[model samples]
Target: MLIVFGLMIAGGALLGGEGDSADNKSDTSAATKSGSSSDSKLKDNYHVGSVANHKGYKFKVNKVTYYDGSDFDKPKKGNRYVICNVTIKNDTDKKQSYNPMDFQLNANGNSTNMMEILTKENYSQNTLDSGDLDPGASVTGNLIGQANKNANLKLEYQPSVWNDETVKVSLY
Candidate 1:
């Protein structure tokens, strides 16, 4: 009876190890409700001009431009306007919604929401707006935000409003 009990325990331990290994493997591809583990580890950081995929949309930051606020539309006391020229492509089978509010500028560990600076003549015509995009279509526009005057910035894209998953794009 003692030998039989030992074998049973050993068998249970082996099975438990297998289950743990399977869970670790799934961690690399599984989408967690809080946040994606593989996504945060691998696909989170992107450089300018590099494409990042989230959900079914492909996003790329073509360029980043900083501007001093005009007299009429000045940034908050210690902030400057950041304009990101980005292109988002819908790669899914159905239509997707794109909005400027989905993008956030991070600087000095603070997240800055996108601002609509339509008063800027240069960006007024090319400003990014909220709309639904059809599959196979792409939209390019400038997403504006306010950041610290001398802070390093990272642009973060939140693909879904319901989920907290975000992809970070390095602006500099």
Candidate 2:
């Protein structure tokens, strides 16, 4: 009886040890697979908009239309600031909320002096509201600034949540 009990205990330990190693190997492989696929997925879905490198951030450009400021019922001028209409899309499958204050404007790869006009805080005072964006839904906004000669503007938006990803937009 003693011999049988000892043999059973030894066999149980060997089987248990082998099972743990197998589990570890499976976990490592799963992690590796997930990491590799993540990059490819990012590149595939990156087609929602165009990207332009600006000050280390990727600015996603949606539309570039010259606005005489009359669209907002403001005075129209011959040499008024060009309002770059942009639609920032959430490429991730998760919901994203955007605060316009998180964005900065740039023209010809240089930061513009129109930071206040581009931020949400300047647009609305006393309202700390962040516009909710559904997965794959885009939030539309405008960057008001003087148009440089042959300007190529880049609009930068950085969401507080999720890994920091820049959407680049180039306007000619």
Candidate 3:
């Protein structure tokens, strides 16, 4: 009876180990598939809004600023991040729906290596769905990301009305 109990305990342990390995593999495969799906979606053609002469319908890069986490005056770290505040105005005399995910930040001139900036360190999609902005209404927000100090920042936006082409505005 004692030998049988010991064998049963060992078998249970082995089974647990196998189960853990399987779970790990399953998690890794799921993560890989999830990442690939996001990549494919990003590569899809998106619409770019045309530059209109309307006073508030234009999008502008208001400012590009950097902050060092340290309070004391030390040389800015090379890895210090930059925050770009983009202002979008809706002067088309109609309501506009904007998806923040469709907006991207480009460093220097490299669009392929573009990094996503989350609103408040969360991975959630930071979209602006304020229904419609009446004529002459404007909205502003910051896109935060890690960047080299003094790096050139560009804002690329695809408007709902425009088809799949990205419009860029640079702040040097």
lDDT of 3 by residue, 66-164 (tens): 655444323336745555555677767667766566666666665422243443432224323334556677776665555556666666777664445
Order of candidates by TM-score, top first?
A: 1, 3, 2
lDDT of 2: 0.53
Give per-model TM-scores. 0.71, 0.46, 0.47
Error of 1 at 33 (Å): 12
Model 1 over residues 111-142: C-alpha lDDT tens digits?
A: 97876575978877788888988989999999
lDDT, model 2, position 104: 53
Over all chains combined, what TM-score does candidate 3 have? 0.47
Clash number for each model: 0, 10, 6
Worst 10 residues of 2 by lDDT: 39-48
lDDT of 3 at 11: 100
Q: Output the TM-score of candidate 1.
A: 0.71
Model 3 residue 165 CA deviation (Å) reads: 3.5
What is the lDDT ranking, best to worst?
1, 3, 2
Comparison by lDDT, 1 against 3, better one: 1
Segments in model 3 whose C-alpha atoms lie over 4 Å from true places: 1-56, 70-77, 109-131
The best candidate by TM-score is: 1
Instruction: Report the Cα lDDT for candidate 1.
Output: 0.83
| TM-score, model 2 to reference | 0.46
